[model samples]
Target: MKRALLALTIVATLATPAYAVLPDEIMADPAKEARARDLSRELRCMVCQNQSIDDSEAPLARDLRLLVRERIAAGDTDAQVIDFLVARYGEFVLLKPRLNSHTWLLWFLTPLAFSVGGIALWRQARRRARTSTERDEALSNLTPDEEARINQLIATEPVSEK
Candidate 1:
């Protein structure tokens, strides 16, 4: 039983790299099939937003795989196929959106947010440090009369054992 389980585990591990491509969707031409696969890997599955069409098992992924193969069979260049998809679905179809004026904000927003947060934190630290220093200085610069009064009060006060 243990040996059977171990064999099953090995088989599953070996088969895990199998893609979501169906037999019917595969192109007869090896070159076109390979190109379709490369393009599929670059395309995003709308249903599984984080997974590429090549890896996603979603119905949308399967459709995209078939679409890519169909384009390849139609003699479309890789770039042309990508352009067609991008035109039809917008840049969101690509796993990585192209850098453009429209997307500049999306790409740069993170660093900009970090920079603003850092500046705010730095200003806060400076303000706190200044306030702390001012408080300490005020406490240390007491008048001689004040020190004398405090000493007198301490002398009169009864000491308690903790």
Candidate 2:
């Protein structure tokens, strides 16, 4: 039992890396780590939608992670670091894309489309209602003589036995 327990503990410890990012990857200062973590959270994971680069294991995510750490260690302010990345990569690099002329239509299009569709449906229903004759006024357009002839034809029809 003691041997089996020791083996289990060793395997579990070996399964996980001592540090996901190597000591070489980290900046010497702890202050930079906080900012690096913040920037990482803001970055999108290209390989995994909805995940931040910090949480992703993809190579691209790792590269981005490294880049952020490098920038932070190089004495770049948080905003400057972010702007640098944005300059290198377009707005698509942002996990939450900013609202702009290029994306305004994309953001508002669904509601606009729904409103237009609703209007079209309402118009179609109004047109159909206007064009159709109600059963109560089936002969409203007919003269008295025409009405009499239709009634006579109905009266002359033979009845069928059920």
lDDT of each: 0.91, 0.82
What's the residue-level lDDT of 18 in candidate 1?
62
Q: Could you tell me the C-alpha RMSD of candidate 2 in Å?
A: 8.9
Number of colliding residue pairs in each model: 0, 0
**C-alpha root-mean-square deviation, each candidate:** 4.8, 8.9
Q: What lDDT score is found at residue 39 in candidate 1? A: 97
Task: Using lDDT, give the best candidate's number.
Answer: 1
Best by TM-score: 1
Q: Tell me the lDDT of model 2 at 145.
A: 97
- Superposed Cα deviation of residue 148, candidate 2 (Å): 10
Model 2 Cα lDDT, one tens digit per residue, 1-162: 999999999999989744335456667678888788788888887788678887777788889889999888788898888889888988777887768987888789989999999999999998878667464377687889999999999999999999
Candidate 1 global CA lDDT score = 0.91
Over the full model, what C-alpha lDDT does candidate 2 score relative to the true structure? Answer: 0.82
The digit string of per-residue lDDT tens for model 1 on 83-132 reads 99999999999888888998998889999999999999999999999999
Residue-level lDDT for 87 in candidate 2: 88
lDDT, candidate 2, at 69:
90
